[model samples]
Target: MGAVRVVLVGGHESADGADLAPVVQQLPEAAVSTPGRSLLSQVRAALAGSDAPVVVLPMTWGRDPVMIAETARTLRWVAGGDAHGRVALSEPFGTTDHLIALLRTAATRTATRWPGSGLVVSAPRASPFDDAELHRVAHLVRVHGAGLEIGVACVGEPADLTLAVDRVRALRPGHVAVVPAGFATACPEADALADVDFVGPLMTTSAVLRVVRERTAGALHDLGHGHDGIAAGLDADHGHGYAHSHGPDGDHTHTHGDHAHAHAPHAPHPDPHATSHASALG
Candidate 1:
């Protein structure tokens, strides 16, 4: 029996990959890296040198199109343009039951002191699009801490740490735990939790990895393969039921002191590079 070769892929600079490291390390044999144009070449070289089955693990914050395309390309190359059995691409970590378990554990750890009442703040990366994992954290907190108040927030938005603090202050909770629902600590959202009074370990890659390893171990045993069923179960268990509000439109006005501020009109694009890059992730 040969060891399975798993390659964990993500945005290396992002916090998510760092959080998934411990999980990847627990595999019998694995390699992890950020996706790039030459990522396929690198994987090919690595696979050529090893005699184990390859599993590509995508540890992304959410379902990103660019990363998905890159993974598809890598799979095609690995399978000689037909991805039948040569390589398998595991689902992204954010949508896994393992992640849900981690969220629950984080909530438990953070709310241990309060026991009956506490705040679980899920601080995700700064983006207009709402991540489903953010809501999952809230759901997990609600489940683990029945009487706890759970709030979801995003960095650089109205639903930010400040709002979370305000909510906590108003409720006068015994403790507050701000979980960074992101991959790495480099992001501002993850850093914002530094001032928060958390009861347990901050949700980091190390914590997430532990959950993933345990979940994968169980999935591997029940389904004959750990990479496939884990994702399906996660998606099936957690339906897309969360709602997010968009910021005010350009017509909205803001008053500051004696001055009023209005949003600027749309600007025309002059460079193809800018447009191309903007659409690349879509």
Candidate 2:
């Protein structure tokens, strides 16, 4: 038997520290780590005390295949050991059914007032794989948002937030929910448009915390079961959420976020040095 280490990896942040207090306090060995120098520093700190197997859980919604590949390369370059092979990365925070509900909850709460409303999921940028996940989640939003005039839109790269906002505005919906796709980070106080209402970040919700634990716990469980390849396979079929009748404990049947929209197959593995380092389970 060997020591096990857990690192909750997150995106670039406004504050030097992570707002993931709920995540770090849950597990002692579990600490917050990001990609690049911050992650290298965290790795060095963890290793200075003991040599243990590491598991990384990405704290993000919408799996970005590009980011994971970049972090793997960064680990290889810094640690100069079995960083890639030994270190295990869990699925992204976004792919779970819990998050689909959280977004629905937040967006639903804010959209209650308006007769005709739009649902907008915002992120840093758009990629082929990320876009696919965003669209899949959008379908779930539409299902849950039965009464409202729900519309799906992407923010950042390939498409601008304004463009999506405009699409919603064109319909002249009573209001629009600018829901952020990421877990937690710095967000503006108010939306620019008078009719647009910000749904805020999901980091504060218990749902986000539950998903974080699931990723870490799932990794530890698999490590106990023995590798059987890599835990990265979670990203393969999980892009569109799952239909389980229970949580990780299998206690209660969860049928809230289920839908029938099929997503594209997982993107192929790319070169070691890739551009988009954002990854999900891989």
Query: What tens digits encode model 2's per-residue C-alpha lDDT throughout 204-228?
Result: 5455556656676666666566651
Clashing pairs in 1: 15-183, 15-184, 16-183, 16-184, 19-205
Deviation (Å) of 45 in candidate 2:
2.7
Candidate 2: minimum summed lDDT over ten consecutive residues — where?
253-262
What is candidate 1's lDDT per residue for 53-99, written digit by digit as tens?
55665665352434544565545546444323445555454443434
lDDT of candidate model 1 versus the reference: 0.49
lDDT of candidate 2 at residue 170, scale 0 to 100: 74
lDDT of each: 0.49, 0.55
Model 1: lDDT of residue 178 = 60
Per candidate, the number of residue pairs that clash is 5, 12
